[model samples]
Target chain A: MARRRGERVTRWLVGGPPGAFLLLFFLLPSLIMIVASFRYPGEFGGLAPLFPAGPGEEGGLTTENYRVFFSDWIYFQIFLKSFGVAAFTTLVCLLMAYPIALLIARSPHQRRDLMVLLVVLPFASNFLVRVYAWMIILGPFDLLFTRSAVILGLVYVHLPFMVLPLYTNLEKHDPVLLDAAQDLGATGWSRFWRVTFPLSLPGIFSGSALVFIPVLGVFAIPEILGGIHDWLVGNMIKEAFLGVRDWPFGSMLSLMLTVCVLAVAGAAAWLAARGLQRA
Target chain B: MRRAALAIEALAIGLLFWSFFSDARYALAGAALAALGAAAALGAFGQRRELPHFWLWFASILVYAFLYLPLAIVVIFSFNDSKLAAEWVGFTTSWYAKLLADVDMLAAARNSVLIALTASAVATVLGTMAGIAMHRYKPRLLPFMVLTPVAMPEILLGVSLLIFFLNTARPALALFGIEFDLGVLTVIIAHITFCIGFVAIIVRARLAGMDESIFEAARDLGATPWETFRRVTLPLIMPGVIAGALMAFTLSIDDFVITFFTSGVGTKTLPLEIYTMIKVAVTPEVNAVSTLLMLLTLGMIVVAGRVAPDVLRGK
Candidate 1:
């Protein structure tokens, strides 16, 4: 009984503060944004109060914010563009990162560790600084503030994301399988195609998802390198809240973005589940 | 087959060097550097019997060059004597001097440091406790709860926090006779909110790896829970905690999006200030500032890696 009481006290002492802090600051703000999405935009800027101004039977709730988002062809185009950019970035990252990850995974122990560190070393620097670095590199090519620049920046910034997961996954692959395949008189290419690639699909999917989701919300790179016209959903959301002062619209957009992210995660999880079952 | 492979490798390396010389005056120098690196890479490849693939080595070298090219450009331009950032007009240290003398930039740096220090300290404690609790208690919801901030887009979190402070937090604070404005305090709050998750993830990994027997031994030796935690648990996890704290500090100092949303008048952090500077023009001064910031963060990561190498690997 004493031990049970002690455990309860320790649990509360340990878990209580962080849980409450997250609830108040993290979760509550998200909840408020959701509530704000249901309201109208105020004149000039900001969100209108959720409650009606007058004391009557009139309700202030409206779906117009979401309606505006769904009805606009321009918004749809931007969303599609964002998705395309993210997909392209993911594809490019995967292609570029795969061989590098494999090389790192297969190298001598010390060299492999060093190569992995080299991949992660970039993260030690500021992301904005790295994007700024790209700005200088893209300057002479007449590519500054262009779509290509943004794509290039996204690939550069997110290469580690694709590489790390692929490395982790490839590291876990059994080397004995390769020997077995070769022992069966299979050539190197055939062995890899038959065994190695199939086993690394989970890693490929995960790395793609990792690169894709973040690339969808890449505002900094786009804003720095791609100019205003190349704005993604992330840039749009930022403009809505900070630039345009349209909180209701911003909140609605935020909700949609969250939904899109959730959908991506759900799909990835489903695919991973299926892949695991097949394996 | 060997000759064909060698031809392809030679052609690829020659094209790589040729492409560098296509644009800037420094391109030839860059090409020369690439040649030197290729030679080194070839030498290393020959020495390593385990690595049988030359094309793989070549491709990996190209990727490394790609990764470091921008950073190298930034560092090189910081020493450029000319006003044009992209051009190399002999080396000079004037930009670094100019960066040191900038008053407003210094203030922003100070603010960034203050915020990072305070936020990381608070986050480290909370995260360590939460990590311990999650590990020891096995709370069902803890994983999702901690990971939400990490998984959410920064802009989403920033805008949400912005809306909250403006609409809810300010009014709530005003009711208690405290003036609430979005400034340094709000930025710190926003930082801590996001930073907690990184710390929690690192600390949790460390906690999970901890030897269960040590704790059992402590208990058997008549050490009370608090005493055990104070000596055994804290010492065992100190490296993880320090690593977590260093990561939080680096992140808080370097954060831009969330800070941009949450900052009001006179609350420009280093990244925010750097963004403003870059938006105006690409000057050598900006490069100098960025180089300094990069050094600081790299130093912190080195320290963190020393404390616990696995912290970086998310082990």
Candidate 2:
């Protein structure tokens, strides 16, 4: 009985603080954001008040924020454009990541770590510095504030994300299978196309997801690199919260974005699992 | 195959020098650097035994070059003597001198250091507890709460936390919020919130590889739980704890977006200051500061890797 009490105390001592911190800092904020989305904007800005100040005061509750978001075509177009950019970026990251990931995986066993580190080294710098690197390079040739520049910045910052997952998946692949395919008179191209590519589907899916989701909500790359017309959902969300001080609308946009992200993550998890099972 | 590779190499060498002469200097320089890298890659791959195809070698080198050449350009341009120096007139360290002299930038750097040190210290403690708790106690909800923040888009956290701080610190923000350093504390909280997960992940990964029997042995040998942890688990996980601290510090210092959302008027971190500078003008001083920031983070990573290599691997 004493030992049981001790165990209980130990559990609380070890786990209680972080659990409480996350609840206050992470969980509560998320819940508040959800609730905030359903509320009305304040007179000056932000949300008016969720609870009544006095007895007769009406609560700040409404579906108008959602209604405004859904009824708007411009917002939908921007969301679509962001998704389109994310898809394109993911595709490009996959293509760029594959060659390096494959090479790293196929490298002489002792050299693999060094090769992987090389791939990750540049990314260790500040994120904005990496973005700024492109500004200097892209400033010339009239490409600084353009769609291609935004795409390029996204691809550069995110390439390592795609590469790491793809490399891990590729590294796990058995070389014996490749030798078996070759022993049966499979040409190099055919061997890769038939066996290697199919086996890497899980990696590709994951890499794509890793590249896709963040690009969807990134405001910085667009804010810094792209022209005025390239505002994504993130840029809009920022405008609502800080610029316009419309906390309700910002919460609404954030909630929608969170839902979209969770859905994509779920789909990726399902697809990756299926791919793993088949492989 | 050799002929084709050589043909590619000659073309690249030609372009590398040609781009230096071209009016659209930087863009062509990037292409030329990619080409030169591809050429060197061919020579290196040619000597390897039983490697991938020459085309693979060619393509992979170009990709690596793409990854690196822009930063190289930034570093190279920082030394150029002119403000809008399209061509290198002479090498100078004036930009670095200018960066040192900038008062606002210096203040931002100081604030960044203060925040990173405090946030990382707190995060390391919380994250270490969470790591040990999950490893030993196996709490289900703790893991999810710890990791979800790390996994979600940073902007989600930023905007949500903006609302959160505004609500929690409403009295302070109630007025104009001019004099209050509310954004600093809030940004610190925000940093710790996101950073805890990474530290936990690294610590947990470190713990996963240890021998479970050791903890059992310490327990059986009449060691109290606290004594066992201090004498055994703590020492073993020291590298991870240190690595986690360094990683958290680096992350806290470099963070911009979440900071951008949460920071008040007076709270200017280095990234925020650099951002405002970038918006104001594209100067070589920005390049100089960026080069320095890269060095700082890189040095930290090297130290982290020395203590705990797996932390560098995102484990």
Candidate 3:
């Protein structure tokens, strides 16, 4: 009985700090953001209580913030654009990364090491620097301030994120399966479609999720490389909260973005889980 | 095979020479290099038994060129004597001298170093503790708590923290007659908050690979829990802790989004400085700064790779 009590105490002590730290800083901040989203913005651009009277009040309880976002064509277009950019970036990253990842996985161990270093070195630098580099490359050729530039920047920024996971999965894959398919007179395309592609779906899904979520909230790239017309939901959030001092609407947009991210992450996690089971 | 190898090498050298003399036109040189690389790769595949060694060397050189060309340009242009940027008249070390003499740049560098060190240290301690806890205890809520910050967007976190600090703390602190600017402190806090997730993930990977029975054995041998941890677990996971700390340091230095939202007017990190410079005007000084920063980050990553290659290998 004494040992059991001591064990429980040790467990609690061990688990308490991280659990509480995360809850307080991460979970609590997000919860506050959610609650504040429903409140009104004060004159100083901070959140006011959702009670009797405030600066941004129309009566008491109101859905004005949500209504504003949903009704406005500009806001709706930004949301659509953000989603479209993230999806397209994910698609392009997967397409580009697949071949490179395959090549790395199939390479000798020493060469694989070199390839991995090449891929991750760019990742270690400041993201802003990488985007700035792209700005230099694209800005001169009149490629800056274009949707294609935004897409290119996103793809460049996220290619490694997609590649790493897919490479991880592919490295562990049994090459004999591919060999067996080939031995059975299967063509290269069919062998990949039937065997390799299916086997690597978990990595593909997780990589896509990783790429998609961050791309959605990436404000810097779109701000730097994109045209005024190519502004994303993140830009809108920044403009609303910081530029226009409209916390209520910004909070609403933030909450909506978080929800979208969560929904997508949940679906991806489910798909990855199913893929794991199949594997 | 030797002839093919020589041919590939000649092609690569010719393209590189063309890149230098071809008015710094990237697309043309890139196309030439790409064509040569493809040809060499095809030759390598066709000759399965005896691989063309020069082709391999050529491919390696091509990879390096592709990866380092932008950085090389940045470094080289920093020395251009002409102030009419991008027009190289001659080479001079004046840019480096100017960079050293700039007080604001020095201040930003100092602030960046301070924030990065503090955040990395705090995050490392917290993340190391968290990693040990999650690995040993297997608490039901561990996964959820760990994944929360990992999944949360930087924009949302930054905005939310801004709101919390400004609205909740500002008034309360004001009543207590305390004045605080949301500059370095806020940036450090934001960095630490996000960095905890990264450190936790890296350390968790290390902890997962550790043998739990080693700790059990230590306990069985009459070592106390703390003693067991200190003797058995800490040493085993020290590599991970170091790797996590290094990663956190790099991340804290590189972070811009969170810093942009949380930083005060006077608090400009190197990235912020470079960003403002780029927006105002592109100069060789900015390129010089970028080149230096890239080299620093590359050095850190290389050290990290040496210390914890397995961690980097995604094992």
- Comparing to the true complex, what docking class would candidate 2 get? medium
Tens-digit per-residue lDDT, B105-161, candidate 2: 899999999999999999999999999999889999999999988877899999888
Candidate 2: list runs displaced more than 4 Å.
Answer: A52-59, B1-51, B171-181
Model 1 Cα lDDT, one tens digit per residue, A1-279: 998899799898998888888888898999999999988787768876667778863337799887888788999898899999999999999989988998888887777767888888876788888888888767876889888899999999889989998898888888999999999999878987898888888888888888888888768788889876678999889888878888888899888888888888788778876766675
What residue pairs clash in candidate 3, if any at all?
none
Against the hidden reference, what TM-scores do the models get?
A: 0.92, 0.93, 0.91
Could you give the candidate ranking by TM-score, starting with the highest? 2, 1, 3
Q: Which candidate is the best by lDDT?
A: 2
State each candidate's chain A TM-score: 0.95, 0.96, 0.92
Among all candidates shown, the one with the greatest DockQ: 2
Q: For all candidates in order, state the fraction of native interface contacts they contain.
A: 0.59, 0.61, 0.46
Give candidate 3's TM-score: 0.91
lDDT of each: 0.83, 0.86, 0.78
Q: What digit string (tens of lDDT, one per residue) describes model 1 on residues B162-204?
A: 9999999988899999999899999998999888898888888
Write candidate 3's Cα lDDT for B1-315 as tens digits: 645754665676567644643466686668777767666665656654564233344444544444455545566677778664534578898888888898988898899999999999988998888777777777777667775666767898888878767766666689999886688998998888888878888888888877778888998899988898788888898889999999899989988888888896878999888878777777667767777788899899889888888767765
